[model samples]
Target: MANYRLVSFKTCPWVQRAAIVLREKKIPFEFQHIEPDNRPDWFRAISPHNKVPVLRIDDRISLFESASIAEYLDETHAPRLHPEDPVERAINRAWIEYMPTFVDLTSGHAYVDSEAEFEKAVAAVPGAFAKLETAIEARKGGPFFNGARYSLVDAAYAPFLQRHLFLERIRKIGQIDRFPRVKAWAVALSERPSTHSFPPAEFEAMYRASVKKRNKWISQFVTEKAAAE
Candidate 1:
């Protein structure tokens, strides 16, 4: 058995995708909490890009973009997360690539900019949701992305699916109900023991608090600028 450690942050979709793969594979590993802004020096040493979701497999350190990580884990682990068939695996990989584009269009990279930017992002949701609706319907036989069993594609996407559901609660984006297949898939994925195992409430609370603080700072900045004028 290889000694394993995963350096990650809760709110990062990339990190969450990797975590989902690890869980599905039933791989035993240590989770090291690293905040995005305050990443530890050791993490920087291991990952030249200073990204979260860096995995240490004994002495070999691996830094992967989420899709690559899922594929690598699926290939290495006991309970496989990918199909053995070449054509099926290609289809799975295609969906995995498709997810990031949907996530980008729907969630708008987590509204990381001005309110004007956020509004523009929110406006893009409907079209993005439409694409997802089509994709989900295409895979309607699925409890997982590839049909019966969960695959690397599902693991790669689970985090974004969760965020899309959560965003519906916080923002008036497109309704998940409009995408019935996706809605069911997200609910089922969320209920998985591994999916539920992470500390969502705690992370959400922290994120909400951070948003409030940032909003307050912006407000104060505006007031100060007006006063100066």
Candidate 2:
């Protein structure tokens, strides 16, 4: 087995996806948290894009971008996470590709300056998730995106769902409830042991700190008591 090191920012969603994939595959890896603002020369040397979620394989090869890192992990590890059927796998890949857009759509609420703008952003959320709901409804079984079996699609979206849950706690957008399938899928992903690859205390602390630092409309919703959880 190659020595894997995941270079990431503690609160990065993209980084979370790669971390989740590693945990799901039961792969042991070293987690290296780097400050995006003060990246070291070594990280810059390995990351052409200067992005988080760089998987340094055996300190020889480096893979940047969450999707590519995930694909590599699935292709190399046992118990492949993607579907066997080529068409089905392609379909899943399409949905996986859509996650970044979905995340952007839902993330707008935090940056908006006013409640009205926040509401508009929140209203736009369901439309993005509705598309996902249709895709999930088309699939066969329970909880996961691909019915009974867990796939890379689930891993791709898990970070978004985890953050969505936190967003809801920060302020109830209620958009998630509008799509039953998406809501259920988020719940199911939350229950997966691999869903939280980062330490809860550390993740929550950094997440809340990031929100507060933004000092935007949503920051008002987060309270000092947030840590009590």
Candidate 3:
């Protein structure tokens, strides 16, 4: 087994991607959560890209980018989180690559600069999810992106799904209402142990305060945040 240390920010969805993979694979790893503004000098020196989700392996090598880290964990560990067949693996990789789009669509409502911008952002999302709903209708099974087996694709989507669920609670955008498969996937991912595992007690409060600080749309549309489910 390799020694693993992950450097991360508390609320980064990207970092959560790697964390989910690590936990799902049952890798014994150390995780350091740093506030963005308070990142350590040593961490900065070692992380060439200066980003969160840097996975330090054996104190000798540091892997930056959440995608790279997740792939490394999946490749090196047992209980593979990806499909075995080459074509299926390629398909899953394509879906995993789409995670960032999910982030942008799901996160815009809370951080857009103006009401019009917020409306535009949220407007683009339903069409995007409609596409996903179509894709997901073809999924063979349930409770995860890959059905019965939890894969890297599920880990990739889980964090953003949680974010959207949070948004649903705050300001009922009904983002997933029209898409039953997408809604069911989101609900299942939200319940996974890895999804709810990280984040400090102050995560929700801090996230809201930060967004409300920067975006009036958040404050106007958001009510008191419910506790994490």
Candidate 4:
């Protein structure tokens, strides 16, 4: 195995995806955590994009971007995470690439400034889930996106799905309840050893604390609602 070092920020969804793929592949890697606000000169020197999820394969080759890191990991390691057939593999890759939309849709609900906004965001959430419901419904018997065989699509979405834990408690949204298949899928992915890897226990606590100061509107809204309930 080539020397591997992954630059990540705990709880960064994009970085979590890369970390999940590394763990799932059973590839030993050095996990280097860096704060985005205070990146060192050496890190910025290597990363033109200045983002987490930069995987250092060696001194000569450093890769940034989650998808590229994942694809590289899948290609280089054994027990391939992507599908074998060309079309099916492409389909899986399409969903893997589509993960950002999942983050966007969930954010609309998770970080609202007011009750009206929360309601509006919550109302819109089903529409998002409805689309995923269609896709997941098509593939029955799945505790995973790819059924028995866990794939890169699962890794891509696991971070997004893991947010359900925080959203359910903080937002009081019955999002997972609305979509049975997706709910089951999230639970399965989260339970997988690799899904729980990377970010430590305090990561979520730290996230909530940071966001509270960052967005007081959301902090007030969620706090009031949480108190009422």
Candidate 5:
């Protein structure tokens, strides 16, 4: 049996982050891909919340949040993903929190047909990116997030950053050129061998399929509502 098993979906940024950390640590495990629309009963059994990135270790199941999982793995595994220093580890944690806040408030809700909402999200990006840019500049030592070493912070943020860059092309939201440090950091991180393991083309196909399905559902809903009226 595989020492670890991860139930996850490729398109979910959270799951992607966990996968990245596992790869970076050179941890061997089994990956079971779950579909967003149709989550399996076994996954729900492992994770009561039915969330992806549920990791099974020696018959112990864990769930609810990717950051925690990454931290857990870092603590357990051979290579440390966070700084040894307590203060630096806290700083790394802060960055992890920061990435998700921006992602949830801005990027996550940004994808819609509304031009106004999209513009609002676009505006928020600069401020969010600015904060990260300053953080990276002030820290100043890394090709990664926290100096020369790759930390849990980088693992936490890499997947979201990758999606941000990918969406720029698919959504036509413009490159992240304004945030030079972040852009550079993302490029370096994406080139890592682990990143290649999470196939981008497959994720994109899944996303497109989701869009089509959602549109069809909406159309049917509207038609049924009109007929009832």
Candidate 6:
């Protein structure tokens, strides 16, 4: 067995995606957390993108990009997470790439300060999810993006959905509620053991802290929750 080390940031969703795939494959690996703002020279040397979720194999070769890391793991390990059919696999890969569009819309919760801006941010979310809703509806299946089976696309979106749930707790975004199928897909992904790949309490604390640090409109809700605890 090859020794594996995953380079990560505590609150990074992308890093969590790689961790989810690792855990799903039952791969034993070491997790190394680093400060994203002050990266070490060694990390910089290995990561051309200077991003977290760098997977190092046997302390020699390093792979960057969460999607690439997840694909590599799925390819090398047993019980493939991707579709066997070439066309289906290609389609799945395309949806995985589409995740950033959805993620970017939800991420506005932590950045927008004014009520007007936040409202605008919230309004834009449904439009983004509508595309996903259409895709889910087209699938004409239940629970996951690819009907009954969970695929790399599910892994790709799990982090974003997890974070969205956290944000919803702070304030009811409810954008996801409009798309029932998409909402069900999110729930199915959440129930999977891999979706909880990171320590939930730890992730919640770190995520809340990051949002608090932003001191935006949403931060007030997070602050209130902290005081209540």
Indicate which candidate wins on TM-score.
Answer: 2
Tens-place lDDT digits, model 3, residues 99-140: 777677767777766778878888978877886776676766
lDDT of 1 by residue, 148-224 (tens): 78877777677777766655544434556776777777777766666643576655455444444555322222221
TM for every model, in the order presented, reads: 0.82, 0.94, 0.91, 0.90, 0.84, 0.93
Off by over 4 Å in 2: 226-229
Instruction: Point to the candidate with the largest lDDT.
Output: 2
lDDT (C-alpha) at residue 1 in model 4: 66
Error of 5 at 21 (Å): 1.2
Output the worst ten-in-a-row residue range by lDDT, candidate 6: 220-229
Between 2 and 3, whose lDDT is larger?
2
Worst-scoring 10-residue span by lDDT in model 1: 220-229
**Steric collisions counted per model:** 0, 0, 0, 0, 2, 0
**Residue-wise lDDT of candidate 5 within 53-158, one digit each (tens)?**
7888866756557877887888888688788888988888887877768676446423445566556667767777778889999999467888778887777777
Quote the lDDT for 150 in model 3: 91
Mind giving the per-residue lDDT tens digits that candidate 2 earns over 60-179? 999999999999999999889999999999998998888889988977898898989998888789889889888888776468998988989999998888778777877877888888
lDDT of 6 by residue, 137-193 (tens): 887756888898878888899888877877877778788888898888877877788
Q: Give the worst 10-residue stretch by lDDT in candidate 2.
A: 220-229
Ranking by lDDT: 2, 6, 3, 4, 5, 1
* Sort by TM-score, top down from the best: 2, 6, 3, 4, 5, 1
The collision pairs in model 1 are none
| lDDT for each candidate structure | 0.68, 0.86, 0.79, 0.77, 0.70, 0.84
Question: Model 5, residue 108: what's the lDDT?
Answer: 45
Quote the lDDT for 71 in model 6: 92
Spell out the clash pairs found in candidate 3. none
